[model samples]
Target: MVSYQNNISSIDNNADADIPVAQYVRMSTEHQRYSTENQQLAIAEYAKRHGMRIVRTYADAGKSGLRIDGRQELQQLLEDVQKSDIEYRAILVYDVSRWGRFPDPDEAAMYEQTCKRNGIQVIYCAEQFSNDGSLQSTIIKNIKRSMAAEYSRELSVKVFAGQTTLIKKGYRQGGSPGYGLRRQLIDENHNIKGMLKRGEHKSIQTDRILLVPGPPEEIETVNFIYRLFLNDGMPERDIANLLNNQKIISETGRPWTRAVVHQILTNEKYIGNNVFNRVSFKLKMRLEKNDPSKWVRKDGAFEAIVPIETFRQVQAVIEKRSKHLDDSHMLEILKAILARHGALSAIIIDEEDDAPSSMTYRNRFGTLLRAYSLIGFHPRRDYAYLEINRTLRKRYPDLISEITSNIEKRGGWVTSNPDNGLFTVNGELTISLVIARCKLGQNGRNRWIIRLDSSLKPDMTIVVRMAICNSTIFDYYILPLTDFSPETLPFKEFNTFTLDVYRVDTLELFYQLTSREALQEVA
Candidate 1:
């Protein structure tokens, strides 16, 4: 009964029947530039191949993938779909995850089902859907999407781990390696930079390879900024704009954000401790703000770029500055900052890769070398040489247990690299590491041990060098009695537990032993 034109018009109303197509593209962080651009290009190419007219293209820039509501373009597209104005033959994208991650998959699947009921189809360019294929295809597609989410999570973990390691190494991890810092590479043997070459943490590790502590000059600059904001009453935004006006880009080549300026003024690394595992989460795929209780902070890992006194002063200033702000809102922002940066304002490390260096070893152990140097232990080598020294496990099987017990008993670090002899819990708060030199002459075989009786847990000392002296003298000190301070300090009961006949020193006995403090500080 109906006319031909009316019949054709009825068929044209179908949303899937429309030839014109629209494209949607998105990226989570500022880092995913290429992947997003590639997706957009792929969508464009698909349009050309299908002979479909190019229509509106929606894009969400700098949007996160954890939640869908935050994406502006996505919401717009959804609203347009609800209005049913234009027929969308297909909503094209590289993959379903390009929609969003986390709660996004469930939300997207629901939205897709609704669209299907409305006579629309989503054409994922990269994912070729097949109904007749193996059941594993569906599982694989789901896994692929899940992996995209996992990829973000894994990347966060790797970045955090890498950065933590680099920060510990003192090679400069980010932002022009804080004042007075110079990057150096550890040779294969883990010696204090076999050559004073570039630090590997900066060049090959993460996006933050040049994360180093402040050098003296830069330390001054850091101090200046902190003082300006707190003592001089300067504002964060004003400081950022001021730095930008001076054409001073941050070490990463980006204009200073107000947040970045604030962080510089508040960071503790500038004082010289390399804290690690401070703000970590199991689900890095959705790294939310971390709880302070969950943070693992190790003090004194590397040589401090800034003075401990200055670092304390800066924290005091920040506390005074932040106290008056709205706690609820500021806490939220702070939480976000913690999630993104783990309380790091700026790191001074090297950004160039050194030969025969793995980014991992440099970051984890290198920080401890710097820390030991700061407290005055004189770390002998760089990350390249840590394995040479870190063999404490092989040398002293009870090393970790001893340290852990000391920490539990005394409850604080005494001193690192104590007397190089028989280490014992002397007083309630004392730990002794014996340092002995074998006499070189006929007397070299007979040695006198210099015992530095210091605090134990309350004053934990990391003994870096067990005995680095004339080789022959090593045998005499190797079996000296001064190794046990508590036994000599009126602890007759402890004497029974101390070693009676000490082992003779050989080339293998001449390695460094980390105090509990040094071990906690590095990783």
Candidate 2:
């Protein structure tokens, strides 16, 4: 448990009473003690005692403080502070932790400094420290930040341990139960509740989930896949092809793939063996597959969908296939494919029955590029894109910084998330910067293909087109999300009026769009 030093004191003497202030409150679902309403009550009381007027409020309900990625309200408060004619002179947060519990204490400090630099005072309404920049207050604030971060770290550990315990006790951990299984909810007394449908979860605290056989048709499909692999000696790709040919869709309502078939064949859950810790993606870090030795297993956790003996036979076959093809043998097959097809790709490799799967080659040789290099077959198109992509990656960060600086010059604040390069401008517009590489066509025409990341779902996308040899900028396209829906936008040297209208030599217009102008009233 984490504790806050709630020595709420009077507002600073240097500040004028009855000054306008903005109260910012945030609450994660982890605790009820720091709900937005509770924080607002504390902040309101502090404002009343200090003679400060609450002119505005920013609340992030059910939002985590670990990162500012989803907390739009706090982001707005930060952006609002940088405005020249900002209404609020001070920001009232319930406490330092409530402001943020960023893993890096420096990040919390950076935000506070951004507020200070813009002449906006951030007062922790519930903290004991006054945030006066005094030596004692600074030390206490730093300690509080560390404590908040440490509390998260501790909670993560406890949660992982609890989940692991639950897994060992034959209860289902996260993730879907696969194609032929359904999640069944049961009470603490082991009474059968109902089967949880897709996206449904148990609301009762004492309720637990267990994996059971799904629909009859899905179970038949699972058994059929196993029989094809074992009895008929069909490869995973062939099995997938046959399933797709029969118009049998997977759990995701999509055609079956070799990967999905392989998962169904190899996953031990079909044999009623519960496994955990096969992969770890703790604390929003990169996903990593753990070693077999580290995996926690509980056999016969659920009813067996396939016979354990048959499952082992299937595993043996897979293991033999993997171990049978050494590096030299895999390279020989790849070279044969390149010789026959005059080109190599994942699809081509998967299509070839004589050749090992592209994934097998990748696992053995780090990546398909390395395998291709070994086989002396390099796809010119892929190589060109790789070089251009590398160059674009190198130029991306500097360009983002330049855009951010330009926006600041026009009195607009930019808040960015390092995880993804999505940034919010003045808390009103979310923008994604894409650098389109120039490709020279056979007809001596330069073309730029902009691959917009619709997943980021930026309100506006700013595409920077490069000139010949990608040596310099050609022009810019500021496209709104509403207008552009396609994942890829191809542009020739000259385009139609609809697209060319967005083209500009400079972002002067864009900067102006974000600029906040002070209005003057004439009596």
RMSD of each: 28.3, 13.5
lDDT of 1 by residue, 202-317 (tens): 23222222234444556566666776775777776677788788776465544675557766765655655544454444542333446666444546655566567766776775
Question: Candidate 2 on 123-177: residue-level lDDT in tens?
Answer: 8877777677778889999999999998888878998898888888999987888
What ranges in model 2 sit over 4 Å off? 1-16, 324-337, 345-371, 383-523
Q: Would you estimate the TM-scores of all the predictions?
A: 0.37, 0.70
Candidate 2 lDDT score at position 439: 72
> Which candidate leads in TM-score?
2
Best by lDDT: 2
Residue 433 miss distance in model 2 (angstroms)? 19
